[model samples]
Target: MTQTDWPSKVTARVADALRARRKELGLSAQDVTDACAALGYPIPRTVIANLESGRRASVDVAELLVLAEVLGVPPITMLFPLGTAPTIEVLPGREVSMWDAVAWVTGESREEAMKTPTQTVLNMFREHGILVSVAMLSRELGEEKRREAALARDPEHRAKFLDMVAELDRIHARDIQSLRNWRARMRELEVVPPALPDEFAYLESSETAQ
Candidate 1:
């Protein structure tokens, strides 16, 4: 497919979120496109490739809905992770960012949501040793950073700061490695879209096909 308009930050975030979900589900571009077709949405594999590569910018509501269905996530979660704290204008005189509303809904401080990892990462960690949530790791990291910044004020806590760092390093080694692998895979997928599979080749007979 021909490239669409230059992508925006929102579209970029959506693309990252979509690619992340697809990888989590072990679904290829062809698998996603076929699922859309089964749902009667008929999303071509090139369209998915373009979207993931940020070559396709805007996504209409129908496409978004079908994509969410295929990926098995709520539609908004596909646009942005739930704890992202994205700002929004609710009404003419009132506005609330996601952080505020979520805090209110959950009866927790905004910091909690900010520190909490997305459900995806939490699930990943659950597959490993303990069910250590992202929030747990984030809290440790956040405290360490905060203490590290104040180290000049109290050099006595330097040892504690180092201890925190070591603890975090030990606890999050797998998560960090997994994140690195995920980013590398994303880079690989950002290359030119894959050629249509044999069954799909007949559907497109042009240089730019979808």
Candidate 2:
């Protein structure tokens, strides 16, 4: 559909996301207005209020980018949420939702599907023995991708970005190796503690009774 032909739901979702983030950051309408001014965009407080209330149907790319930067989030995050299931056409006659594909990819191991909030939270708790801030990790990765994309757009910065990415990869590899070694060491040490004296005597008494 053309941009003008887009449904109100589309605009509403964007509005909801922006409003939620603003509230989450404890930013008032005036705060957003002042931030926009500092960024040289100079969006009025009334404009921000209109955007959050869905009175503004469309936001220009430049404004959205500046707003996202000021709000400490990637631009697409304010436009569309990552939690929604994406529609993928696998074949001419077949289609699969992104969520279903993620579930299939994850299998029924320590982790499962990460498509829905409930499933993602459950999997995080299961795999990490607690949540372990997986959501924060996802946000960090998202920001990294955003920065990489921004750097890729600049010919002068691409080489430096490549070197930085290479160093990041090396660090990640070392961290992974260290984690594996730690796990191996933990496995080598017996995890089961010695039985208590009372439990041992109980077992002996049960054996004798038998």
Q: All candidates' lDDT scores?
A: 0.61, 0.58
lDDT per residue, candidate 2, 67-89, as tens digits? 88878887655544557648533
lDDT of 1: 0.61
The window of 10 residues in a row where model 2 has the poorest summed lDDT is 191-200
- Where does candidate 1 have its weakest 10-residue lDDT segment? 123-132
Query: Once model 1 is optimally superposed onto the true structure by TM-score, how far is the C-alpha of residue 176 displaced, in angstroms?
Result: 51
Write down the lDDT that model 2 would get. 0.58
Which residue pairs in model 1 clash with each other?
none
Error of model 1, residue 97, in angstroms? 2.6
lDDT of 1 by residue, 125-169 (tens): 333323224424654685666568566466667666766666676
Q: Model 1, which residues run further than 4 Å from truth?
A: 1-7, 85-96, 100-210
